[model samples]
Target: MNKKLIIGMILGAILGIFCILGARLRLPDHASFSYLLSFWYNRVILGVIIGLLPSLKSLKLSLLRGLLVGVFVSFAFYSATGFLDLMGFFAGFVYGVIIEFVLFKLNQMEKL
Candidate 1:
């Protein structure tokens, strides 16, 4: 197993747990944060995939993967809060794309 992937997963999980705790504590809800939490977690998970699998580096492939996870998270949030959060779904995609692009740039720099 790749160590970077393992570390990314652990870090993502920790971030997710902290997000939940923070939300429960009423310390600025998810909306108040402008879906950054959702964006970050989505990025972390997808970024790990990008790091581990080169095939997922394409923008189309990354967006598909991000959409799948984002919609799922949105649905989960709706179920838990009884309110749909489409912004989170969109933010997830944005962040996932951002991470992929950044990864692409880093790989390019590695070749230089």
Candidate 2:
């Protein structure tokens, strides 16, 4: 298995778990079992996408790449939910940066 892939998946799962918890708190009345499950799946897919992206020479470029990907990937869910969750859409951008930053650091550490 690819190291980046594994790292991305783990990070994705962790972030997804957090998102689930947060959603539960925020929409306790509206959240259904299937909705939360799919939401978490979306984050996992983001991680997989992040893991598969080729490494960039510039750190800024790498992070930016992630950010873009995040927004793109997150848009699917946002629109699916009828654009009701603006925060979730924006959070995708943050998650993208965080995932990229972590991947960058891990790769850097590997070289040490």
Which one is best on TM-score? Answer: 2
Worst 10 residues of 1 by lDDT: 103-112
Candidates' lDDT values, in order? 0.50, 0.85
Model 1, range 1-112, lDDT digits (tens) per residue?
A: 6644554455445545544554545434544454546534644665465446553446676556545654554455445545554444454455444544554455455521
Model 2 spans with C-alpha error above 4 angstroms: none
Worst 10 residues of 2 by lDDT: 103-112
Q: Give the TM-score of candidate 2.
A: 0.94
TM-score of each: 0.46, 0.94
TM-score (C-alpha, index-matched) for candidate 1: 0.46
